[model samples]
Target: MNRRELREQIFMLLFRVEFNQKDDMPEQCTLFLEDGDTEISEKDAAYIRSKYEKIAEKLPEIDKLINETAIGWDTQRMGKVELTIIRLAVYEIRFDETVPTGVAINEAVELAKKFGQEGSSGFVNGILAKFA
Candidate 1:
């Protein structure tokens, strides 16, 4: 699937993890890919799932950085979707060497536009730029 579709899957997976606190991400992902509404290939589903799980695993450190980097805001004050998007972008920027840092932050901005509150895209972009 394309990058936008992949990002949607990532957002769904992270949203699920945040709200449900599910631990069996691989199994959950397999079920979601097989049964959910999104149209994506098996390989792409696996990639998104892996990305979500990896980010979840490093959430503490990631959220810590997000909390520190967010100048006037705290992690708890941020909406869950925005926080999750930031975590995913930060993971890609810091750990996933295959994706350039600029792309990672831009992707997060796009996601914020799609899923965040009005003006949140700018907020997300501004925070991510610090890491870029």
Candidate 2:
């Protein structure tokens, strides 16, 4: 899988985090990889899983940055799609040195356009711009 595909997988896994209990994430991650219609190579699967784990480990700090930068909007109040996109973008922007800040922001906006609600791209772009 390409980087974009890996990012989408990571975002999907992160979205699952919002719904599942922490204890279930390992199983959920396994099932996600195993049950997919499209097969992912072991190398790509490992990359996705590792990146997801790292981002999840830093979620508290990520959310804190969102809370601090988002002004009046609380993290809980944000749409799940938008919040998930933000989390992914934030992870790339702050933690992953391999992804450029501009590329991260642009890819995040693209993901928002693809997966988020109406106006979600703009909303996500605005929030991520703070970090950029």
Candidate 3:
């Protein structure tokens, strides 16, 4: 899968975090991979899992950044979809060196448009714009 596809997959996987307990993530991730609409190759699956894990690992710091940057919007009070997208973008922008900042913000907005409420894209763009 391409980077965008991978990001989408990661986003979907990460979305589960808001709904499940920390201990449940391993099973959740495995079930998510097994139940995907399209069959994923072992290599892509591994990549997705690793990247998801890395993102999950950094979520505390990511959420911190979000809390700091988006005034009046803590992770708890934010919409689940927007919070999830912001978490991924924050990780990419602040942690992942390979992803250009523009690409991270743009892809996150795309994800927001695809999975979030009608105004999600703009909300995501507005929040992300504060980062760079």
TM-score of candidate 3 to 2 decimals: 0.97
Per-residue lDDT value at 129 in model 1: 89
* Residue 88 accuracy (lDDT) in model 3: 91
Residue-by-residue lDDT tens digits, candidate 1, 1-132: 888778778887887776664566667777788888867776887788778778888888988898888899878898888888888888999888988998898888889988889988998898898888
Candidate 2: list runs displaced more than 4 Å: none
Candidate 3 C-alpha error for residue 84, in Å: 0.5
Deviation in angstroms for 22 in model 1?
A: 3.9
Ranking by TM-score: 2, 3, 1
Each prediction's RMSD over C-alphas, in Å, is 1.6, 0.7, 0.8
Pairs that clash in candidate 3:
none
**Cα distance off (Å), candidate 2, residue 128:** 0.4
Score every model by TM-score: 0.89, 0.98, 0.97
**Model 1: lDDT to the true structure:** 0.83
Better of 1 and 3 by TM-score: 3
Worst 10 residues of 2 by lDDT: 32-41
Q: Scored by CA lDDT, what does every candidate get?
A: 0.83, 0.92, 0.92
lDDT string for model 3 (1-132, tens) is 898998999999999999999999999999989887978888989988999999999988889889999987888899999999999998899888999999999999999999999999999999999997
Q: Least lDDT summed over 10 consecutive residues: which range in candidate 3?
A: 33-42
